[model samples]
Target: MKIKLYCRRALMTLLFICALYTTISSISNITLADMKVWAERVQQETNHPSENSLKKSNLEQKTMNEQTYRPKTLEEAIDFDQYETATVLATGYTAGIESTGKTSEHPQYGITFSGVKVKRDLYSTIAADPDIFPIGTILFIPNYGYGVVADIGSAIKGNSIDLYYDTVDDVYSQWGKQELDVYIVEYGDGTLTEEALKALNEAEALQVFRQQYIEQ
Candidate 1:
């Protein structure tokens, strides 16, 4: 009787150990399967796309970049004569030398003109003729470097453009009066119309004497 009882107890202990091991193994397998499913779902979401959204975004960016820097039409690409004004290129010289009689020690060595100023009136021209040239234009001059259309000018009234020189010497040295082609860079205000430009030309550009100087 004693031996039979001892044998029964040993049998029950072995069964309990097997049950625990089976439960642990089943739990581990379940956890691994769940992890794999989650990883697959994440990858699928990342790979999927709605439509041509990416392509459309890329195209829009390209257009904007080209419009910002490149001139599309022939009118956008124009050439004009440049007039030189000053001999030296320096900032704030006028203010510095206004009080002091001394002019040479101010840093820049160049002749200053009293009455004339020149500029390229890009906005006005674009406003006058959008068909010819659009706003937000960029221009490139080979020898003159690059300039943006910041504002309009009275002399730069038509398809004409005005170039600025640092000095009279530079203007003469570089042949300021000669014609040069200008590439339309970006866009700005507008282009000048033919009619407006003609009117500007007909008007008196300069006045030498006021009026009625009859030997008084």
Candidate 2:
């Protein structure tokens, strides 16, 4: 009777161990399968970008470019509603040592601050305080027609301008220091790009600029 009882207990113990081993093996197999699936999903995303993500990236780049874009021309740059009439203290100057403190032998003799050669007479070159009128600003003087602000003077501050003349005699005889009525036709884009400056350095570029933007 004792031997039969011992065999029954041993059989029950063996069955319990077998059941635990089966449960552990099943859990291990399920965990390995889940890991394999997760790794494959990560690799797929790494290898190929989604169409929606690509479109989003492109849209972001376009928005950034639009925000940074600047107008390159007077027509595109200026706001006509901002135009106003102004009274200015006007002086006269020629490309001479007395006016510019530079001789013809100097490399920057005829060159204005905007990198353009000075043109004489009506609708010609003028100097002003760059703080008020930046390079490429167009002003219409009652007697002078139209003059572009392309230079700056040490003494020209606030509402003041130094009109350019062909000769020193013209400066003395025609225009001296006086008050003038001037119109602010259009404001400049307030930029001096190296490419634009280099192009303006050409002899005929001033004529082209005048015809395109000023003569009208």
TM-score of each: 0.27, 0.51
Alpha carbon lDDT at 176, candidate 2: 75
Estimate, for each residue in 1-216, the C-alpha lDDT of model 2 and write its tens digit: 999999999999999988876787687765556768979987986798678878989999999998898554444444534669888999989888998899999999988887777875334778888888887777876555467788888888999999888778877777778897777976777644445533543436234334433332
Q: For candidate 1, lDDT tens digit of each residue in 1-216?
A: 999999999999999987876787687755556768979877875697335766777889999998798543323443323322212111111112331232555443222121112222221121112233333344544444433332333333445544444334544565345454555545445543344433432335211111211110
| Whole-structure CA lDDT of model 1 | 0.40
Clashing pairs for model 2 are: none
Q: Summing lDDT over every window of 10 consecutive residues in candidate 1, give the lowest-scoring window.
A: 207-216
Clashes of each: 22, 0
Evaluated with lDDT, which candidate comes out highest? Answer: 2
Worst 10 residues of 2 by lDDT: 207-216
Candidate 1, position 38, lDDT: 78
